[model samples]
Target: MSAASEKSTGLRIVTVPVPLSGRPCEASASSLGEILALFKIGCLLKVTGNQVLAPLDGTITDIDSSQLSVKLKADNGLQLWIKVSEVSLQGHGAGCFTRVKVKDRVKAAEVLFQFNPAMLKLAGALPFARVIITNGQKIERFETTKARQCLAFEDTLFTLYV
Candidate 1:
């Protein structure tokens, strides 16, 4: 463990929310450039697993079933937007199963949704998840784990300083 892993004042820890075995990379602009441009500070995780977990303890403020996305407000007031699949898959939520609903309080590592990665691939959509800090102004800085690949609930994704 590093110094950042230790509990400290004004620091909040976020973990890998998806139970997928893949690498985390800086989010890039896709075909939906305008929409993705808003996610300047975001991470993209390659899909491998079926379940998406809560990155931190938070309440689901909004859920778009057809879009396969969830907006959560952390206990510390930080907001997050987690979206599965790319723009092409939007409104085609056939294989995606959302487990949590709006207003539901979830713990870190709680299952948020599940999807069939194979099905997404067969549909010509690259399976991935976009995790973005919606209210980034509240964060002073954040350090991402050095590891290239991370496991959900077990690996710390980012240590946020408020």
Candidate 2:
């Protein structure tokens, strides 16, 4: 199916993966221009700490060997990507800690992974973790909240309509 055709429906909600207390940074074409251009990502969430949480109820579809990146297929059919480092740092998964595996079922607010923020920083990588709709183009009706909000795990980042 086309990316746009894969959109989620039925009043699905998407959330941030980290605690809002960490001073989250939002991603955009302007703010994360280079990074987004390079990774082909449309959104991002940067936090100061290492813990990563599941942003929605979903089954793990893919996980990188380093465990720093995961792809989740939500119960509502949305595909989400959560990563510790940028695409450039994909090989550096050793600095991260992942708790789930491919095919594992997870709920929103559940702990999925953690990383050594200090180590990631030392490697010249941004500690900005991200929770994004991997198949967003296919989604037709979704509302996203403003970036830079102090959002907790399970806090609604966006609402998807069927």
Candidate 3:
């Protein structure tokens, strides 16, 4: 068998906590139902955090202007064609919320909107990432196929299947 193949002969897929990124559970004029209807500029987003910490704590990448195949990081290619309507994260990273629109003024730590990373293909966190010991390689995954509760820095949140 090929090296990569042989190495993965007994490997298993496991899900782990990725961290819920944003929470816009507040009163707002715009409904999530409205934002999701958009398929263009207000679509697809990137976050830089895990389900164990606050979101928006890292750099953000936007895919609103570029089509999927051309506008994403190579490492993030797994997320391609996932039909992301928005990218949300909690305090610290470039966040997601209803406060976003063209030409709108925003600042760090400001509430953008309400988002529970548990709803999208991945609201970020997942409790199913496994650790396999096939050929001595560490593997972890956040599956779009299953959504479960993942712990976050002293807290726990139920991530929904998106």
TM-score of each: 0.78, 0.68, 0.22
- Per-residue lDDT of candidate 3, residues 36-141 (tens digit): 2332112112322322222112222332311111121112112111122333333223232333333333332333233333443344432121111111112232
The digit string of per-residue lDDT tens for model 2 on 1-162 reads 333545432343343343322444445522332354443224455665567677778899998746377888888777776666653444445466568888999997777776777777777766565556666665546655555654557455655543
After superposing candidate 3 on the true structure, give the runs of residues whose Cα lies further than 4 Å from its correct spot.
1-16, 21-59, 63-76, 80-148, 153-162
Which candidate comes out best when scored by lDDT? 1
The lDDT, on a scale of 0 to 1, for candidate 1 is 0.69
Model with the higher lDDT, candidate 2 or 3: 2
What is the TM-score of candidate 3? 0.22
Query: What lDDT score belongs to each candidate, Candidate 1 first?
Result: 0.69, 0.60, 0.26
| Shift in Å, residue 115, candidate 1 | 0.2
Candidate 1 ranges with C-alpha deviation above 4 Å: 1-21, 29-40, 88-93
Q: The CA-based lDDT of model 2 is what?
A: 0.60
Q: Give Cα distance to truth, residue 140, candidate 3, Å.
A: 14
Question: Any idea what lDDT model 3 has?
Answer: 0.26
